[model samples]
Structures are given as C-alpha cells and as structure tokens.
Target: MLKTLSAYIGEYKKVSIKTPIYIIVEVLMEILIPFVTASIIDKGIQAGDMSKVLMYGGLMLVLAFISLFAGIQAGKYSALASTGFACNLREGIYSNIQNFAFSNIDKYSTAGLITRMTTDVTNVQNAYQMILRIAVRAPLMMICSMVMCFIINPTLSFIFLGALILLGFVLFFIIYKVTPIFTEGFAKYDDLNASVQENVTGIRVVKAFVREDHENKKFSKAAGNLYKIFVKAESWLAFNNPIMMFVIYGSIIALSWFAAHFITDGTMTTGNLTSMFCYVMSMMMSLMMLSMIFVMVSMSVASARRIAEVLNEKADITNPENPVMEVPDGRIDFNHVNFTYKKDSDKDALEDIDIHINAGETIGIIGGTGCGKSSFVNLISRLYDVKDGSVCVGGIDVRDYDLETLRNEVSVVLQKNVLFSGTILDNLRWGDENASEEDCIEACRQACADEFIERMPDKYNTWIEQGGSNVSGGQRQRLCIARALLKHPKVLILDDSTSAVDTATDAKIKKAFATKIPGTTKIIVSQRISSIQDADRILVLENGCVSGFDTHENLVENNKVYREIYEVQTQGGGDFDEAGE
Candidate 1:
C-alpha cells in the first residue's frame, strides 16, 4: 500500500525532499541555542566578562533567526507537496474509474468511490504533511538534545532515558488498541456517505411518500454507528496526552533534584544544571511530537488501504493490440452470445443470443422487464464483454476494434435518460463536439424536441440544471434523443427512451427517424406494441431467449408470445409487459 500510494508523489518529490532538509537545518539551530545560553551564564556572567556575554548572546540571536526561517520554508514546502499529492490521487482514481468496464464498476458502490476520493484522500494528505515535517524534526531533535545533555552531566541525563522507555511502551500500547477501532470506523464512513447520497438524490420521492421520518431514522443509524466507533477509539487515545505529560514532569523533577546535589558537591556547575533543564524540555517535547505523529499515522492507515484499492484496480476491458480504427457500416451480429453480470452466477443475463441485423434496417425489440433488452444492446458497444461467443459491429469483432471507434458508431440512449448541467446546445454537443448551432437544431428537430425547446424562454441556449431536473420527464427523454441523433451513428439503439413521451409524440419521433435518417439502423425497445409495429422486423424475447424474430404480421399469426402481446394491445387491454410485472 505504501509503495502504491508513494507513486502518486510524482512531481512533488523535489518539494518533499526540500521540506526535510529545511527541518534538519531547523533542528540543528534549535539544538545549539541551549549550549550558547550555558556559555553565556557560566563563562560570562559568573566570571564577570561582559564581552563573552555579548558574543554568545549575539550568536544565539543569529541562530534563532535562522531557525525561524527554516521553519517557514519547511511549512511552505510541506503544504505544496501534500496538496499536490492529494490532487494527483483524486485525478488518478477518477481516470481509472472512467476506464472501468461495467463489470468492474459493479464491484464497488457509488458512495464507496466518492468516500475514497474525498475523505480518504484528505486523511492521507494530512498524514503525509505530518510525516514530511514532524516525523523528521522529532527524532533528530531528541537524539541531538540527548547527546548535549550527556556531555554536560551524564548522571542526570539517564532520567530522560528512563522516561523515554516508559513513554515508548505506553504510546505503543495506545496505538495498537486504537488502530483496529479506527479501521472499522472508516468502513462505516461508506455507509454514512451512501445514506446521504441516496437521500439527496431521491429527495423528491422521499417527500412524496411522506417518509421523512423514516429517512431520518435511517441516516441517524448510520451516523450513530460511526460516532460510536470513533468515541471508542478516542477513549483509548485519551491516555496519550496525560501519560506523556506525567513522564515529562517526572523527568524534570528527577533531573533537578540530582543536579542540585551534584552542583553542591562541585561535580556540576550552575551553568551545566541550567543547560540540562533545557535539554530535558527539548527531549520531552520531541517525544510528545513523536506520539502525535504515530497517532496520525494510525488513523490514516485505513484510509491509505482504501485509496490503494482503487489505484491498483486493473481495467477488465481493453482494446486489442492491433485494433480496427474505423466502423464501416451499421450491420450488427450477435453470434451465440452468452453473458452474465457475475462470472459464477447460475443464470446468465443473456443466453445463447443469436441475432443478426442488417445495415439501415429498422428493428424493434419487445421484452419484459428482465428479458435482457438493455444487456443485449450493451454488448454491441463492449460496455461489458460477452462471456461466450462474439458480438460483431461493421463485420469486425467489437473487441478487435478500438473501443472509442466502436462506441462512437453505435450510439445508445439507455432506458434511464440523463442530461448534464449545461445549456441545451451544450448537452447536444456531447454527441458531436464540433457540431455548430445549425447542426444542433437539426438533431433536435429529428428527435421531435424542437417543438418544446422553441416554447422554452431561452430555446437551445437555456441552462439545464444538473440531471435535467428542471425539465419534465418527457422533455428530458427528447433532449437525450436529440443528443444521440447528433452523433449521426451508424446504429441507433433506444432502450425504452420514448416511454416518457406520449404515444403520438413517440410515433412522430419514429416517423422523423424514417424520413430524416433512413440509412441509419434503428433499434427500438418498448413496452407499447404501436411504437414498433411498423418496423421492418420485430424481435420478441422471453426468459433470456429470442422467442420470435420476424415481421410484425408473421409474429402475430404464428408466435405465441408475440401473438398474445399483439392481442392484448390491439384489444385495448392495457400495455404488454412480458415479465408479467
């Protein structure tokens, strides 16, 4: 985990190195001040020499200023390195997520990823800053102060050694006890984040159902779990400060007592006793800082592990070594395909699907809720690879083509319509970045979206809220269709995209597809029979298998599943749901 995380410190290595160099310089200056003070007291004041006093005092002032400057430089470099490391980590995780196949994404939750990118990264950054500055300063300061004290009065210095050994064991015990609690606490952070995310995103539904109290209770439970774990860890950590202060004060008293008798016996001078006190203070404070560093490190270990998980995750889908860059035409072929969202699952999402679609042909797909309508189309763009057999686009296996090239040629407006926060023109431009104002309007017209867009106050220039929350469901669907149409893809797959629009408007969009873009292969997945009855061919799927694939007239007369659906819709017996939902 350390090796993986340290790799992100890319360009910041120079700054990271500089921070510790400055810290070491600061420690050296700090260690010299006490020695200079001891000289001023014994050789100058006690011996009645004003010149020695002035010289040593001036030297102390110079060291003080140099130490202050080094400290400032250390702080500056530490900040730059830590914040830069955090930015690089977030970027790395997001870039990796963008490359994950659908199956890879299923391994992690949305809230879990968000927590790793934000809270976990922040923890790691704080720990890194502490490591760069305090981690270097504390140990060096302690060792240098110890050496100084022993040179002056070795007998009194042993008190500091004894205190350090006792404190070391105490600190080690505290860290070991608290680390596991903090690890469990960080895991609970994901649950807390997930609760917040679900509540905020579906706030309207929560309010509509009058489940505010229920949601409150749910959030409280997650928050309460996190609070309990932290409280338990902190209760154990509370011993650190008190134990450190005990050893610090006890060492000072012991050293003072020993030094007083040594001075009376003429074994230690008054100046030596004073310097011993200074060394004692520096050594104890250094130990205190070391304890704090250990605490920060313990808290960050869990977060560091979480971040490493994302950084180390390999992409499950990658383009072939020698890939086809161009998609020649719209023809699609699924030859005996088998796919399962889970590799070891008993049932496949799509099973033995052998279907062939010709170029520019309008094919209609009708299936129940779980009949794999979306799954079947997803394979065409290689969003998820098939477990068995091959999916071919433009006469080449999808895996053999450049991923970007294949997806660009086969545009799919999924069952859930999505629009980003942007102007209508901006959202449409996602389909074609270089498309002009005229081109956007033309795509909107083809999708039958221009009618309402013109009615809006700002038309194409109107700003859309995130997720298109400002627009009605039908309007959002139409805008998504316009975005896909702008792609001018060879094959256009609409997975229940028109379900939100009225039947009449849905019919008009289909008509526009036939008249405006006849050479594009259109595949429509719908619950309504009328939306697809006019297609060149219709595919009826049931229980993950194709029940029938023929023209509408032949399916109604021969296929049982297709005939029942046609009968139900024609006799106004409500919509046809093959899943029987």
Candidate 2:
C-alpha cells in the first residue's frame, strides 16, 4: 500500500525532500541552545567573566533566529508538498476510475469511491505532512537531547532511559487499541456518504412519497454509528496525555533530587544541572510528538490501503495488443453467446443467444423485466465480454477491435437518459465534438427535438441543469436521442430510450431513423408493440434466451409469445411484459 501511494507523489518529490532537510537544521539549532546555556552559566557567570556570558548569549540568540527561520521554511514546504501530493492522489484515482470497465466499477459503490477520493485522501495527506515534519524532527530532537545529557553526566542519563521505556510501552498499547477502531470507522464513512448521496439524488422521490422522517432516521443511524466508533477510539486515546504528563513530572522530580546530591558531592556542576533540566523537557516533548505521530499514522494506514486498492485495480476489459482499428459495417452477429454479470454466478444473464443483424436493418427487441433486452445490446458494443462464444460486428470479433473505435461506431442510448450541466448544444456535442451548429440542428430535427428547441427562448444554447432536471421527461428523452443521432454511428441501440415520449413522437423518431440514417443498423428495445410493429424483424426474449426472432406478422401467426403480446396490446393497451405475466 505504501509503495502504491508513494508513486502518486509525482512532481512534489523535491519539496517533500526539502521539508525534512529544514526540519533537521531546526532540530540541530534547538539542541545547540541548551549546550550554549551551560557554558554561559559555568564558564562566565560562576567565574565572574561578563565577556564570556555576553559572547555565549549572543551565540544563543543567533542559533534561536536560525531555528525560527528553518522552522518557517519547513512549515511552508511541508504544506506545499502535502497539498500537492493530495491533488495528485485525487487526480490519479479519478483518472484510474475513468478507465475501469463495468465489471471493475461494479466492485465499488459510487459513495465508497467518493469517500476514498475525498475523506480518505485527506487523511493520508495530513499524515504525510506530519511524517515529513514531526516524524523527522521528534526522533532527531529526542536522540540529540539524550546525547547531550550523556555528555554532561552519564549516570544521570539512565533516569531518562527508564522514562523512555515506560512511555514507549504505554504509547504502544494505546496505538494497538486505537488502530482497528479507526479502520472500522472509515468503513462507516462509506455508509454515511452513501446515505447522503441516495437522499440528495432522489430528494424529489422522497418528498413525493412523504418519507422525509424515514430518510432522517436512516441518516441519523449512519451518523450515529460513525459517532460511536470515534468515541470508543477517543476514550482509549484520552489516557495518552495524562500518562505522558505523569511520566514527565516524575522524571523531572527524580532528576532534581539526584542532581542536588551530585552538586553537593562536586560530581556535577550547577550549570550542568540546569542544562539537564532543559534537555529533559526537550526529550519529553519529543516523546509526546512521537505519540501523536503514531496515532495519526495508525489512522492513515487504513486510508492508504483504501487508496491503493483503487490505484492497483486493473480494468478487466482492455483493447487487444494488436487491435483492429476500424469497424467495417453495422452487421452484428451474436454467435451462441453466453454471459453472466458476476463471474462466479452459475446462471447467465444472457444464454446461448444466436442472432444476426445485417447492416442498416431496423430490429426491435421486446421482453419482460430481467429478460436480457439490455444485456443483449450491451454485448453488441462490447460494454461487457461474453462468457462463451463471440459477439461480432462486420464478421470480426468485437474483442479484436480497439475499444474506442468499436464504441464510437456503435452508439448506445441507454435506458437511463443522462445530460450534463451545460447548454443543450454542449450536451449534443458529446456525440460529435467537432460537429457544426448546422449539423447539430439537423440531428435534433431528425430526433424530433427541434420543436422544443425552437419553443425555448435560447433554443439550442439554453443551459441544462444537472441531469437535465429542468427539462420534462419527454424533453430529456428527445434531447438524448438528438445527442445520440449526432454520433453518426454505424449501429445505434436505443434501450427503451423513447419510453418517456408520447407514442406519436416515438413513431416520428423511428420514422426519422428509417429515413435520415438509412445505413445505420437500428436496434430498439421497447415494451410497446405499437412502437416496433413496423420493424424489419422483431426479437422475443424469455428467461435470457430467444423465444422468437422473425417479422411481426409471421411471429403473430406462428409464435405463442408474440401472438399473446399482440392480442393483449391490440385489444386493450397492455405492454409486452404485462402480456407475458
């Protein structure tokens, strides 16, 4: 995990290195001040020489100013390095997430990824800053102070050694108890974030159902879980400060008692005793800083592991080494394909699917819920790989094609219609980045979206709210259709994308597809029989397998499933799924 996280340091390596160099200089200056104080007291004050006292005092002032300057430089560099490291981490995680295949994405929840990118990365950033400054400074200060104590009087230094042993054991115990709790707490963060995301995204539905109180209770439960975990961990950490203070005070009293006897016996000078006091405080404070560093590092270890998981995750689907660069035509063939969403699953989402579609042919797919209408089309664009057999376009295996090349040639308008927070033209431009204004208007016209565009004040330039929330459902669907049309793909798959539009508008969009883009292989997945009755051929799916694949009239006469659906819809207005049930 450390190795993975360190790779994202990128360009900040120099600043990170400079922070610790400045910290070392600051520690050296701080350590020298106590040594100088001893000379001023013993060689000058006790011997009645004011010149020596003034000289040592001036030298101490110089060291003190140097320490202050070094400290300021360390602080500035640590902040720059840590914040830069955090920015790089977030960018690396986001860039990796963009490359994740559907299977890779399914392994993590939206809220979980968001938490890792934000809260987890921030924790690691803070820990990195502490490691660069305090981690380097504390141990150096402690060791240097210990060496100074030993130089003055070796026997007196044993008292600090015993104190160090006691505090080390106490700190170790506290960290061991706290580490697991912090790990569990970060997992609770994912739950808390998930609750907020779900509530905010579906706020309209929650208000419509009058479930505000329920949502409040749900959020409170997640927040309460996190609160309990932190409190439990903090209760253990509360012992740290008190224990450190007790050890520090006890060591000081012992030193003072021993030094008084040593001074009386002429074994230690009064100057040396005073310097011992300064060294003891410096050593004890360094220990305290070390303890704090341990706590921070313990918390960030969990965050670091979470971040590494994202960075190390390799996409399950990738382009072949020597990939086919172009799609020849829209002719799609699913040759005995078998697929499952989960790798370990026994059941397939689509099983033994053998169907062929010629270039420019219009095909309609009808099925009940969970009958693999979306799953079948998903394979056409290689959104997922088939478990068995091959899904081919233009008689070439889809896996052989470059991912970008294949996806660009086969544009899919999913069941969920999505639009970004931009102008209507901006959303349409996603289909073709270099498409002219005239080209965009033409695509909108073919999708029958021009009517609404002309009615709006700004027309194509009107800003769309996030997720196109400002627009009606039908308007959103038409705009999405227009966007897909701008792709000029060899094959276009509309997975119930026209469900929101009225039947007349749906018919017009279909007619426009048949006329405007004749060479594009069109596949429409719908529950409405009237929407697809005029297609070249229709596919009927049942339980992840094809029940019928033929012309609508031929299916009505020969296929039981198709006859039942036609009878129900023609008589009293029922959907394919309703007829199936």
Candidate 3:
C-alpha cells in the first residue's frame, strides 16, 4: 500500500510542496468553521444585538467563501497533479511494453496486456485523483474534529472515539473480505476479454464451422463466472455502507443526547451543546467518506499490483550496456546454435544448427508447422536469445548490439499483420516516420496495394479500421509489406507474409521487391514451395533442426523432405500464372 502511494505521489515532484500547502489551508478552514458556528450560537445569538449578530454572521459567511475559494484552487491543482501523473505512468508502461522482447509479449496474452493498459491504468488514475481530495482531507477532518470535540466536552468526545474505533474495524473487515473477491473478478475479466477478442477476430472460422452457439456458450460461461465474482465483491462492498451509516448515526444520536443532558445540567451551554451536535455530524460524514476511500483503495490496490506486475517485468532479452551493434548489410550466421523455450529446461527448440548467409542473398525456410522456422527468424532479430550458442549478425553476437540498431537493420512482416487505426499514409509512415507521399505510393506499388488503395475516395488518406478489419486479409498483408518496404532495412523477412494472397499476386509482389528493393537481403518462410522456389537458397527444418539447406533445384535433387513438400504444393504442377491480358 505504501509502495502504491509512493508510486502515485512520485509522479508530481514539481507540485508536491504547493499541493500540501493548499491542503493545509483547506484543513484549517474546515477546523475553523465549526468553532465560528459555536461562537455565533453562544455569544451573538444569545445577546440578540443585530449589529453584533450581523458581524459574526457576516464573518462566518466570509470564512465560508474563503474555504470555497481555497477548495477550488486545491481542486485545480489536484486535477493537474493526477492528470499529469496518470499520463506519465501510462506512457512509461507503454514504452516498456514496446521494448519488451518477443518472449515477454508471448508470456502475457494480448487480452492480458490490453487489460493492463486500459482497466489497470484507469484504476491507478482513480486512486491518484482520490488521494488528494478525500484521502488527505478525511484524515484531517477526523483528527481536527476529535481534537475540537475533546476541547468542547471531554465526556462526549470519548463516545465519539469509541464509535470511530468500531467504524474503523468494520471497514477493515470489509476490505479483508472484498480484496480477494475483486482479484478473482479481474482475472475472470481477462478470461472474458480473451474469449470475446478471439471470437471476434476469428469470427470467420467460427461461422464457417457453425460454432456460433459453441462460442456463445464459451463466452457465456466466462461471463457467468465473472458475474459471480463481481457480485461477491460488490456484495461485501455494499454491506459496509449501510452498516457504516447505522453505526455512525447511532453514535451521533448517543453523542447528541449526552450533550443535551449536559446542557440541562448547566455544565455545558446550549451553544456548546449545539456545537457538539454539529461536530458529531461533521465527524460522521467524514468517517463515511473514509469508509468509501478504504473500499476503493482496496479495490484499486489489487488493480495496481496487476499493472505493476507488467511494468516491473524485466524481459528475457535486453541489450548489454557496451554491446556492438549488428551489421546493417546482413551477413547473418548461426554457429552451432542450440536454443530452448525454457531457461532451466532440457527441451530444445533448435539444436546443433550451423548456418551462414552473405549480404543481399535470399534464404528460404521450408518446414511443417511447429518446425521452429518462426523461432529461427525470431532468434535472428534477437527476439529471444539462443540458450546454448551464439546467433551473430556480421560475426558479432546479437546480444552485443543495441536493440534499436538491431531492429532497424532487420525488418519482419509477420504472417498475421495488424494495421493500426489511421490513414493509409499514416500506417506506411510507421516504418519511416518522415517518409513522403511519393515514397508511400512507391512502396504501395511495390507491395501491389496502390491499385485498391487509389480506388478508395480518400486515396492515401483513407482510414484503416482497427486490425485492418475493413480490408481483405490480402490487402492487409500488402499494406504491411508496403509499411515494411518503406523502412528499407538491410535484412527483410517475409514470415509467410503472402499466405493470404493468391500465388500469382504473391509472385508479382516478390518480383517487385527484386526489382525495386535491390541489394536488400530476404528471408522467406513459407509452407508453399512455389512461394520460395526462386530463392537463392532454401532451408528445410524438421523437429527444430535444420535438416537441409541449399538452392531450390538442388534441394529438389538432394533433400527428400524438400522434394516431398514441393510435390505436395504443386500436386500436378498447375500453373499459377494469370492468362495474358
């Protein structure tokens, strides 16, 4: 809890001093108002002097104005402090996620990361905003109210203290029970999010299989479990409020009655008795506010820990401080590389692999699904460090280079390409932020995307729906290629990037790359033999090992698996060429 508080407060070192001063002024006003009210009741009202009455009454009104003005000023700063704090923390988390290696991203599911970004950040923001207003003020009002009560009448103050202790215990019980429930609820929320996202994204597959009912039931089960957890947490949270109101009201009633008896006994004046009632009311209200703070604090604390879990994660991959950057010309090498998914396990993803490639050469990786072709490409880019041996770019180990330089030298367009919500030009500029209109169009042309994009009314300025859902799978892949092409990296990887497009379109796109992006090294990972048949070399992977590596013609001659794959792809060797037009 203290760590969470420190994390939030640390965001605004600049306004720290000024914020507390404003709080002090506000608290002081709160303390003074009750005292002034008692004096008006006892002295001014009893005397019935219009001038004297008007004087203290006007003074009370002036104090009210002063308090209101101070509250407004404090509110403005509190908003500034909280807004700036949330913004910085959110940006820091986003930056950290962006830098996280592939291993780290795979460890946390997409839904889990989205939850942290949206719901978790929102929780922290609410807690931060609340701390300045209720967190600080509640304690001040509680303390000062207690102190004033004792000064007015010590006997009644004891009752107030006892009631507070009871209320505090109740709130504690509320937190102790509800905290676990909320944690479970948020976890369920993640499951629900994952189910919904998967169903929506894979809606075509689900509908094709006629599994809408199955998917709905799957979603319903998750949502139902979440509903139970949400109910349990909210139930405990709800139980506290009414109990708090009853206890506080009961305390106030007892205190007021006790003060009345004192007034009749002439030990306390009527105004003093009235003031005690007023203080009791003020104190109870503050205590109620305090109860709410603890409840939300408990809930948000759970969320903060979840968010901090991601923020505090140290990725499995990071650059060494004085590391050498990989060569930009893409002379890639893997010297007896043995790699594993687990750090402390004997399960190898790839073992006893040795390979090298010259700059500007095209390498084709052909394998069955789960043959570690994807893993091999991931390693080249230093997404995950090889466990047992070194992966070198230009003879220097990948770990030696700074992440930014390594990434800039190698570009990858994944099989599942995502386009962010923006204009076509904006999406392309992701590869090269300062790329011009002409550069974008040229890239689009090379990727076979310019024709369809130009037909849109807005052309380059046409909007891309999130995940590029508005466009066909082929179009999304093309745009992603254009985006990657715009970068002009030394090593370009097409990781089954044209799987969505027909063979003819894929061939034309590759031809464009050969013509326009000359001297750029290419790594094509594809299941379709024809897709990579023209490469300078092809690698056949079997059970995480590189079983064969050679030219397409030679692989067909020498490698049985490669030949078989080619046979399976072509069947009768039908032509993919479009009819002359």
Clash pairs detected, candidate 1? none
Using lDDT as the measure, what is the rank order of every candidate, best first? Answer: 2, 1, 3
Q: What is the C-alpha lDDT of each candidate?
A: 0.92, 0.94, 0.82
Candidate 3's displacement at residue 559, Å, is 2.3
Deviation in Å, model 2, residue 85 alpha carbon: 1.1
Candidate 3: where is the Cα deviation over 4 Å? 1-11, 14-20, 204-212, 325-328, 450-462, 513-518, 572-581
Total clashes for model 2: 0
Top candidate when judged by lDDT against the true structure = 2
Instruction: Count steric clashes of candidate 3.
Output: 0
Off by over 4 Å in 1: 578-581
Please give the lDDT score at residue 438 for candidate 2.
Answer: 98
Write candidate 1's Cα lDDT for 1-581 as tens digits: 99999999999999999999999999999999989998999999999999999999999999999999999999999999999999999999999999999888999999999999999999999999999999999999999999998899787778899899999999999999999998999999999999999999999999999999999999999999999999999999899999999998898888878778998999988888888888889999999999998999999999999999989999899989999999999999999999998888999988899999999999999977798888888898899999999999888899999999888889999888899998999999999999999999999998889999999999999999999999999999999999999889999999888888999999999999999989899999889899999999999988788999999999988999988888888896668873321
Give the per-residue lDDT digits (tens) of candidate 2, residues 315-377: 989989999998999999999999999989989999899999999999999978899999999
Q: Estimate each model's TM-score.
A: 0.98, 0.98, 0.91
Off by over 4 Å in 2: 578-581
Choose 1 or 2, whichever is better by lDDT: 2
lDDT of 3 at 10: 68
